[model samples]
Target chain A: MKRVAYPQMGNLGISVKSFLWELGAEPIEPSPISKRTMDLGVQNAPEFACLPLKVNLGNHLESIEKGAEYLLMAGGIGPCRFGYYGEVQREILQDLQKDAEMIVIEPNIFSIYWSFNYLHGGFVSPLRLYRILKFAMKKMKAIDDLERITQYLRPRAKKPQQVNLRYQKYLKLLDQAASEDRIKELKAEGIERLQELNNPEVKDVVHVGIVGEIYQVLEPYVSLNIEEKLGEMGVQVHRELFLSHWVMDHILKRVDRSSYINAATPYLGAMIGGHGQETVGQAVLYAREGLDGVIQLAPFTCMPEIVAESILPVVSEREQIPILSLFFDEHSGEAGVQTRIEAFVDLIKRRSERSVLA
Target chain B: MRGYLGIDVGSVSTNIVFTNEQMEVLDSLYIRTQGRPIDAVQRGMAQMYDKDGDLQILGVGTTGSGRHLIGAMVGADCIKNEITAHAVAASHLNPEVRTVLEIGGQDSKIILLRQGIVVDFAMNTVCAAGTGSFLDQQASRLGIPIEKFGELALQSQNPVRIAGRCSVFAESDMIHKQQMGHNTSDIIAGLCAALVRNYLNNVGKGKNIQEPVTFQGGVAANVGIRQAFEDALKVQVIVPEHYNVMGAIGCALLAREEVHNGEKSSKFKGFEMLDMEFQASSFECDGCPNHCEVINFKQNGKLIARWGARCPRWEVG
Candidate 1:
């Protein structure tokens, strides 16, 4: 197995590509998740599978057809059914007799290093491999930092489209940036450009926080670009979920989340896997920050999200902050999603206006 | 004569309602969209214009799947979703109403309200097995008029069991029941019961449905489905007089509030807009792999509105 491919999620694919290259294997680009890919996934997957699994299956098949020899996927271990996805996908692929080797890497602090030692296997020096890993992390960090700027400026930019343009440009620039200084300089320049386009502050702007499953929160395709929609509707959206952040928090365990744990205790006593606790924690944090509303997006039948959904009403009622829970699947309609979002925005706007009068 | 105007364009029907400042209904009309929303909107507005002359519109609102498209066409002040619209209309009709069971042409939704505010809501878009279109298709297939479907269903003492998880499954099951010598009325009632079951399991799943539930939408016009709902919940389901056009009524109420809140002049372009020549055109933009089908609207050959593009490249200035 020479060339490896993984399912694309936001800009994580680029980072993974760099990782595979350093591992002495070429990385084939998984095709972008589109209607065709989703259709292919749905055709091969079980009818009731969640959206991400179907997309991942489609990505694997697309890469295999493109001559990818190895498939690198992550493993989940929790109450969430995502833990069984890898085994199920491998079984499905084996049943089809696809000409590819599947490798499921458990994403953990030690497992990541172990996977590194296993995939490399004396091809590259340990020192060089460590350097490659560090550079990839820097690349991911750059991507997340630039996205944070977009989330801040998109709602305030005089030409909102310009912020999107700059954000896209930064994605490409980050890919080419080899050294840490170049990435930092690019990040600084990107923030400066977005700041220049931002319009004067408008008071009483509805502030919303987005929290839910990681992919649904980060992948614009799944959530239907909800952050952008909220931005265009004159609502400032705060999203704390990022792929790079996940790496540091979940794998490295470096980021301090005592605040999240403390806030989630009243609603969720413990983590129920699949970011369920984090979702509730984030909602509470948003409420404390005086956000007007919070929107939770998840795939249909997501176990962890289902738990979060059940507990969100209590958080909403007690915190006096409104929450809108949106679930999507292959059959989810964009128009329906848009209608609910627009109504939710209007509801918050009206509620805030009434409060202001009182 | 200062009234608000509301428009609701769904997959199967286009409805418009006119309401006075107090949110009381004045005139309303329901027309089949027939796969062309623009023509339906224009025709409905033209009929409204022909009936009520010298009626000044204070504000306009649009709802349903095509809210944005029609809101732009009608110069609407507030464009809301069917959930909020249904909740508003239901609450207006029954102040203590806590649940709204809306089954439209191709979609169904369960909205939970508390203290006249929308507390939670769920919509079933992918599954059309329990929607108005499903009933319409089955009615046509069984050689029964849709208007009489409910009346026939009410006559059945023993409703046969039909799978209502998906439209295809339900159709096949209906055929099997028919092949087994099931009466037409029993089969119809069975389908109605199945739809109610599917709805409660899917759209209303995990939703705390409280009493004083108001069932509205095109499907609510069917007395059989209404009774099935009553039997399922064991609570009398109230079907408002304007159940079929509640979305439009809610939109009008929203428009009235929007206009009153800002205390600004109405943005309505006036009835003269109906006389203007407006055209809509769509084209696929191959700038990327997505090839989004961007839509644009022109009035008298001037591009006035454009959307549906993922990037700025396909945007019409």
Candidate 2:
């Protein structure tokens, strides 16, 4: 087996690893993200960059350093920024003197031969590949479900330590479930273990709102499992941008405006450019909805989100919504990230205390 | 007489509309968001109060991305998406209208319809070059107020061609044309033409734009842009009288329809919500690889609603 490694999206490393392990292959860990890695990326890439590209660029460089034979990259061909990310990043990586087989998986209609060929080449036996995809989907769902249930329990736990114990127990079981050949057995055990976990209520916990790039928000490995650590500190976590909302906003409503524009109106008009509008809208929503504080995560040199970051201070000032912007590149230190989060939590707590005293 | 109130809160503006039992718009107010939606809403409500003395508000509906927050604040009976609200409003305005063109201060959208069903629509979220902001910037550069932009454009006998591909290109092209001795009226005309051109090339790309069309939002106020659009499409464009606050009007209509049908009591917090102090906060979850960032709500030091979590598994009563 040509065990290739690529820095996939956030939380993807572990999932890919588990998937690889199930395939009877040992997968190498993609190189960690670092400042130097991003610097190399920026040098090789275009001026207009999304956060995911910078992070992935650093990932590809790091993975090459780790002796990976091939780079696994997903391609999006759509109207969005994602469509051009793969090609741009690939050229950047190659220019920077990284030698690795770049496997670009293009997402397109079935008519696209490149997509068909890529899939056919990746898996030798069609039946086996079907089985693998099926298993991967189930495992992904289980892991997502497990994370969802445990995240809530940790915050509400009266005994913060108990929440950590339950969280760890569930995480282990989820990992085990992903690796299990008989997924049914793992599923049953996972559900039973989750139901049996003791959850206590933690009072006066700090609440923090997480908002940023879609991948950065969901992938635990990317954000360093920021949500779990917050729960361990007895902080309540509220994340903006749900998959459901994104789907409704992006997929469904995308066509909802078709009835409004015509020959007379001619142009379909332009978009609000960046998440600036959405961030402003969300910050106000958070303020009105009564969130304690907000943390915005964006990859270093991300244009759209940078616009949002600029306006967030105004949102914070006007709505009295405390918002912190965290820009991450491959070089972001775990300790530094944790310290900032800890301080933010402390700030919210002190603010809460002050509000009560007044 | 039973009535409904609708609130549409967008990034640049806040709109409030009132409708009678039959869902007919009685009055409305369009307030600049001015980066303070809460204050805008209060001011709008105060305006409504002044307009209609002792009109019983039976229900309230809120829409747009900020619908939930505003809905919660106003104790709304129904909270809906902008698409749904726009569709409802457009359908009511002209049942035969098959297409709706909404271009606001920051964003633009084209909604296609086949007999009142929203068959297809496209929204551009990543471009400002084709939006009203571009026009505002150009108006400033010309030392002309936005309100006077259309009038000046109408005076142009000859319109120059400015690059309509992007804001940067259009702006540089405009400055170059100005240096080349193009009259201000012609330049304004060229700017409007560029805006429409950019809109078509970018947002309206690959879409079939049909007729029975309605133009709306703040951008619709610019007659120069409307004429430019007409020149491009070679068709007559109809602008609704209440085009500026159609979203709010739509929500109010929806609310009226809901309440008249004996729906549950409106969730609107009432007029007193304008005075309440609310707090919001968020934290990260490191429990798993899915580092979910969650948000919560507090009113007067009491924890209220919490949202933004993928799994509602953490919510409490």
Candidate 3:
């Protein structure tokens, strides 16, 4: 079996590991992102590359050090810089003299066939491949659902840490579950456990929507655990970007993108690539839903998000919802991010209180 | 003689203010942090105690970058970010204030307010250009007292143009102009103009800078920068009486609100903390691959707080 490795993006690692395992490849899990990873990434990545690419490079380097022979990554075809991450990272690895093969699964009309054939030998039956993919999809959906439940329960829980603990516990159990029925059971059990943590006394929690680039919104390490921080501050976060949502919309072609595109028509008429259009669309949707505020997170120097950030203020004005745009980079300090979030929460809370009294 | 205490421990200065029930400032202190926030807070407290020992502190509030650390140390009733603190202070001082342009030691911000409520705000991210520290460096490099930097700029007959997009380029531009034998005042005036241009383009970008604008923060003390803002906005800028200590005043106002909002008593640890020793230390936790730097804050050789761990393993209240 060939040793395969992939970068981490929140809980997507579990599904990817399972998929690789099903293909009869030994999946090498890169160590969880740390300070050293960031340092290594910053040293090697191009000076102007976005944070996700740098972090991804660090993951590849770490995995290579662990003797992984194959690196699996998704390819893109858009104006956004993400489309070239695979090629650029491959060159960087080759320059470093690392012995590894880059396998980029590009999204195209025949992506399904090409990816399957490349990842699996002809010996594996098509029925088995279908089963493996379906199981992985189920796991992804289950993880996303649990995450959504955790966000809802976090602010309402008497002890937010308990919800986090249970969420982590269930994630581990779901990762270990072999059967689809067990995964479904574990997800249901996790929701029930999380629901029990709600505090009756806690009410009038602030609601904020998170709309941003997919990597920053999904990966806690890259975005600095913003969802958890907001939740701890008694704000219920509504995140629009999820791994399962992206896969369904972009890969499976099951979810429709017209609603978001139409909503973004006023602010962003065309897709500027990446999740920019979706970000603007979701802010509008969240505003219509009467969410008190919305936060847009993006990596510094990201073209798509920069476009979205510029237009979000107009949406915030027209929709009467406050929006804060935070751009992350290698130098982003925890204290600065914390201060901004605290002030934003305070601003929305005060606005809501005043409206209620009036 | 009862009042609230507010402390703003910033990168450059530690400001302390005492406000009466009516939110009027009774006394204030501005001292250099000198790279030691705890010592600065302690010194400020000692000075405040010596002057107003009989006066009772009803509540204590903290703000600025070092707010959390100082809040924990002083047992603050309320701790708020500098943005909220500045906005609250500006609005309270001038209820009709619509915009606030605050340039502090290390960071600068533009806050838009509507009907005394903060509607929008933007802070400088990943860049420290056009801030007070930059102006300070330039002033010293030109061999002029920072206190007289503004006065010198006003004397310029023709201000030279200096690049203001980045501090590195700005410094090189200043040096080139200086070596060319241009008048020092013209160079100083040009530097002020450049800084203001940078501020408006960077920190105040895309925001409405309506009238009734108030400029506060330590940088407001520079008449040159204030003049540059007036020139750029073509409107009079109001500098509040307590401009430098506005952040402290805001949290003091907030602390009063907090105390009045059904809180029985303040959590103030009192001025006696001035005599006690507080130690903060941190170490990398290798329990996981994340290698989170867990910080331990000790007060008088006893552990009071631990944080910075990604997981809740090391966190303590």
Candidate 4:
């Protein structure tokens, strides 16, 4: 079996490993992103490339060093720079003289079919392929469901660390589950274990919606574990960009994008590519839902998010919800981000108190 | 007399302030951090203690970049970010303050307040082009005292236009203007204008900067930048009396609030910490691939705190 590897994106490696294994390839799990990975990525990538691309390059380089023969990447078609990430990474890899084949799975049906056939050597029958795909999809959904539950319980829990630990433990168990029924059982058991930590006395938990580029929002390493930080600060975080949500909208074509698009119409009338429209739309939705505040995270020099960032203040004003926009780069420091978040929480809390008095 | 202590350990300066029960600043001190925050904070505390050793400290608060470290060291009753600290100080000084433009050593921020509540705020991200440190560098490069740089700008008849997008480009642009036979005062005035333009365009972007604006921070001492702001915003900018120590004053006020709201006693470790030997060290944890740098803080050969690890394995409370 050919050794296949993919970049790390949050818990995406779990489902991707399952998918690759089902396709009869040896899945090479690249090590989790670390400081060395960032260093290697920054040393090689173009000076102006977005952070995700640099980190992805580092993942690919590390995987190549592990003797992986094939690299799997997703391709896109949009005005956002993400669409060209694959091509740029491929060129960077070739320049480094790395012996690996780049297999890009585009958003089109034909590309998916071709990639699957190539990876599996056309030996896996259609029925078996369908079963494999369904199993992977189920795992993705299971992971996302557990994540949502964790977010819900994090702020309400007596010890938020307990919820975090339980979630991590369950993620490991779910990754090892072979059967669909086992996955379902594990997810239910995990949720029950996490629910036990929730404290009934915890009230008025601050709710903040996170809207941003998909990679930064989904990947903990890239975004600096912002959700966990907020959760520890006694704030419940909500985000629309889950890996399963991406799969549902792009791969399965099941999501109804109209509501978000309509909500974004006033601020961003057209899709400026990437998750920019989705970000604006979700902020509006969160505002309408009376969330305490909104946080927009974007990579420095990101075009789509820049457009969204510029327009978000208007939405913030019209909707009467405070929004904080944070831009991340390779040099982004943890202290600065922490300070901004602390101040933002304080601002919203004071605002809410004034309104109550009024 | 009973008082509250606030300490702001910023990149360029460390400020300590003592406030009375009515939130009035009784005494304040501003000292250079000089790239050593702990030492600077310790020195500032020693000086404040020397002058007001008899004042009973009811509560202790900390703000600025080194707030956590200092807060932990002093056993602060309340710790807050510089934004909230500055906003609180501004609003307390004048209840009608609608906007606050604060430019410190390495960070610049704009906070918008509505009815004494902070409605919106933005801080300079990934850039330090127009902050105090940059201005200090330019002043020294021109062989002029930073204290007199603003006065020189006021003497210019026709200010040249300087690019303010980046510090390197702005410096080069200033040199080019100087080589073209422009007066030093004109170049200084142009630099002030450029810094103000950059501040308004970057940190103050997409926000309604209303009148009753109050500018405070170490940089607020520059009359040239204040005049430039007045010209750009078309409103008289009020610089509070204790502009440089506003953050410390704010945290002192917050400390009072925190103490009054339910805390029976302050957690202050007391002023003797100035003489105690405090040490901080860090090492990379290789337990996982993340290799997080875990920091250990010690005082008098006793472990006080351990943090900075991504995982809780290395964290000590």
Q: Can you tell me which runs of candidate 2 are displaced by over 4 Å?
A: A1-5, A9-44, A47-55, A60-174, A177-184, A187-358, B51-53, B260-263
Per-residue lDDT tens digits of candidate 3, residues B1-317?
Answer: 78899999999999999988778899999999999999999998898889878878889899999998899899999999999999999999889999999999999999999888888999999878889999899888878999999999999999999999999999999999999999999999999999999999988888889989999999999998899999999999999999999999999988988888325599998778988999999999987556778888889988888777766778675
Better of 1 and 4 by lDDT: 4
Alpha-carbon lDDT of model 2: 0.68
User: B17-41, model 1: which lDDT tens digit per residue?
Assistant: 9887778888989999999887899
TM-score-based ranking: 4, 3, 1, 2
Return the number of clashes found in candidate 1. 0
Give fnat of each prediction, in order: 0.28, 0.00, 0.47, 0.78
Give the top-scoring candidate (lDDT). 4
User: In terms of TM-score, which candidate is strongest?
Assistant: 4
lDDT of 4 by residue, B15-91 (tens): 99988888888889999999888899888878877876777889999999999888889999999999999999999
Write one digit per residue (lDDT tens) for candidate 1, span A61-135.
999999988888888777777778878889999988998888888876566667666666544566787789898
TM-score of the candidate numbered 4?
A: 0.98
DockQ for each numbered candidate = 0.39, 0.01, 0.62, 0.72
Task: Looking at model 4, give its docking quality level.
Answer: medium
Interface RMSD after interface superposition, each candidate: 2.5, 19.0, 1.7, 1.7
lDDT of 2 at A294: 82
